[model samples]
Target: MSADTPYREELAHALRVVHAASVLTKSVLRSLKNSVSAETKADDSPVTIADFAAQALIISALHAVYPADAFLGEESADQLRKNEGLAERVWQLVQQAQFSDVQQRENAHARLVFPATKEEMLDVIDRGTNAQLKGRVWVMDPVDGTATFMTGNQYAVCLCLLVDGVQQVTAIGCPNLRVNPQNPVNVKVHEELVDESGFGVILSAIRGEGTSVRTMLSDGLGEPCKIEVRSSTGGKEIKDLDLIESALGSTSLSQAEHKAVAEEVGAKWPGTVIWSQQMKYIALTLGATDVMLRLPLDKARYTHVWDHAGGQLLFQEVGGIIQDIDGGSIDFSHGRRILGDNNYGMIATQPGVFEKVNEAVKAVLARRT
Candidate 1:
């Protein structure tokens, strides 16, 4: 009998595409500089040229190999069609985009194809608007933190593959994240870290195979190094654990509510607040933070699948755990939104700490109700 190969090709392709997308975004940031502008989406979130261009580039590159796979991404071409100027800007960026590393471009150019025209670029961006939840689907957040990106801080290019609604592969590129975790970059610090040689990381994971990381380079990805969460906090109590949460107030619990949870858990209040959700997952995977919590201000609102899909798998593969407030598995089969009876806020932490953290999260959230 032959052995089963699970998402091997898909994982490789995803890593390559995500690295390319990160390059494209960093280029946009460098070129635009102070001139960067964003259009407000219907949800009132900001969308920039980087977001549109990255989405187009990733979807097109992935589709080149898996033409039959469906895509669900954060950006669509609907706005592009309405505003010709914005559309033109995104198209130009897409055309000029290439792998930052010369060696990577040379190696990937043969297999990955960029959109040939502005029209095709828009179409390629729209192709990711697939709403179906079945079969093989790729979920992407071209630029996970537009606000953070604009500030010249940290952001991520997130990509994941799901088959039958189960996460199979995840690849995320954090362009501004310090390649060396030992000298961790503080999100609160506005000054960007300078590593002229190369200064980013791409983390990837395939189902049951565990997680690995490689430095983002001007030539290609660095050698893969397997990673896992910090060993069980051991004697550390919940209060002693290092925690991370959202820097943005919109998607996370209120300041007072957050404080209560931290106090309840015995951790420091207002524990690290990084703007991007996926980046928080990466932080946990790298053992930068021991716990992450996201208690929605509004329980009825569903979280976009793209926001958490990629990060969830990467963290879990590294011995981390993620569950809704009620401790149920997150349901990704509900198409774009993670909807179900138990769908509530999120709690991601190291393996041994989930139970205690989840209990504290529920206790704090329950008081509000």
Candidate 2:
């Protein structure tokens, strides 16, 4: 490795850990046998056992190789710490996950030990609870869409490397995501472009390096081909643009506002409503959808960092632009939340259409105030 490319080695190590964790998550999902169970978190969101296991698997593996790297994730061990039975269940799940035969037999690092005791497991799970924001932190969302995961629909195992709060690399594992749009897993969108076939795609990108996509079933080590945003017309023409929006409603985002902006821009008005921001970003990169808009229902709420960290960088690296509705860049340095005072959510599109969409959003928002 060259001295100038310090991130090269770390990026490889990160990819390995993320790939292994993706395998673990897929295995855990399979073990569910199609019946999903979830426990509500303090914030009223759903969390499944697979979430905890995936977080522990990835964090522990990376910690072994990069002990100096910090860890931050979505699931915490607080609930498990308060309930021994839950802790035992999660521990058993983690134990059942093992490196694949190829990994164990061919890779020397596979010999590294995993957390053996209940205490160790809980400690590893609690790693995400750390409040530190600065430095080289490994941010992850063990499972991005618990609801979609439960339905055996769309979800993602998202992770990224942020140095001093700026994203440097992003990797996402979409176990059920269709690589080729011709054979879409279950497209809710209006139009179909090209035809392609494959299931489960893994996307990764470094800051300067362009984005690449591969099949996740290959353990994320498959031959990766480069990808870019379809076009950069900036929503210049209504009929030519494809759009996506949030299907699941949240207090922070307004569907009416989304509709208004779509109309303002002469867009089809009723764009595809997709689940999970991570997957929506993937669709944009794959050219499934040309633009994605996320707006808050109100001003008090902020988009969580985990939701956008991986997908945001992935889009930017692929020649797409992502920013707040105000045309400002997203700020990820503010601890766990996006370091911003506004609740505009995010608007993403190729370079040319970004300004057009922003202006339409401004016009729509201006009418409300």
Candidate 3:
């Protein structure tokens, strides 16, 4: 680590913790291959052992290092406390969880402390309930795409450091993502899910320091390489740019709106639909697609900060831009959810195309009224 690096310690800790969480989640997913079981949250979203265990593992590791920092995570230990069997299952996963590579385990710099007992696991998981949005706070989504994880597809282990509500550092580990940018992601989903060899990638960014990627190895992360979005659209028209959208089925309303915006912008319809928001951001950073849009189903819907916080920083550091659908900057200061004036949604694009895309989004969405 260089002395001049911004958030050097924080970034390194995030990378290591996210890597451990990825390993834990991958194991849980493999087990699900035999039998799938999950609990439904009040929001109607599914929660699995992977989600709870990963959250516990990450928050505990982070708490060991930065005791003073607050945390806002997507999962709570409430359900675990209510169900003893569920808590035991989660504890088992947390107890056995560790960095898979011998080098990572033995390396003093990368090793992490795990919870010793079930009670400690539940306590660590509850530590993430801190709601204080100010000061040094860590935001995490242990399993950003739990649904995708259940289906044996793409998901991410995400963590971000926020200082006074500003994203300072971000780390996301995609266990099933293909490390090779040249290869198509759709064809090799199953192979990447089942095989750990050269299958994973972790992306991290420090505020103002740009973004970098490393191949996830059993031993540890490979060499870091700087990454940025594609230079320009190569003189392509607005309609010609490739677009990516959410893969979750609940986004049908947004999907329908996306088609209208795509038609209005002259971009292609039925843009690439990936499993998670972070993965969609990854697609943009990797040049897998040119743009991504998330139009709220209605004015009442609010996008969670955890879903976009880390990925947003990664995209911006790589020369991409993100904004609310109405063309304002996406605000993270509102605590858990991104509360804008309206539920127009979000737009992410290559550097030069945000304005054009936002304009089309507004134009198309305006007609819905």
User: Each candidate's lDDT (Cα)?
Assistant: 0.78, 0.73, 0.78
Q: Clashes in each model (backbone N, CA, C under 3 Å)?
A: 2, 6, 1
A best-first ranking of the candidates according to their TM-score comes to: 3, 1, 2
Over 10-49, each residue of candidate 1 has an lDDT whose tens digit, in order, gives: 8778888888888788777777662467899988999998
TM-score of each: 0.90, 0.89, 0.90
> Which residue pairs collide, candidate 2?
182-196, 234-352, 234-353, 252-296, 252-297, 253-297
User: Positional deviation of 207 in candidate 3, in angstroms?
Assistant: 1.1
Model 2: lDDT to the true structure: 0.73
**Mind giving the per-residue lDDT tens digits that candidate 2 earns over 133-211?**
6898889998888877776667888888888888887888887665542333224432222112333667888887877
Q: What's the CA error at residue 20 for candidate 3, in Å? A: 0.7
Error of 1 at 305 (Å): 0.3
The TM-score obtained by model 3 is 0.90
How much is 346 displaced in model 1, in angstroms?
1.3
Looking at model 1, report the run of 10 residues with the lowest lDDT sum: 182-191
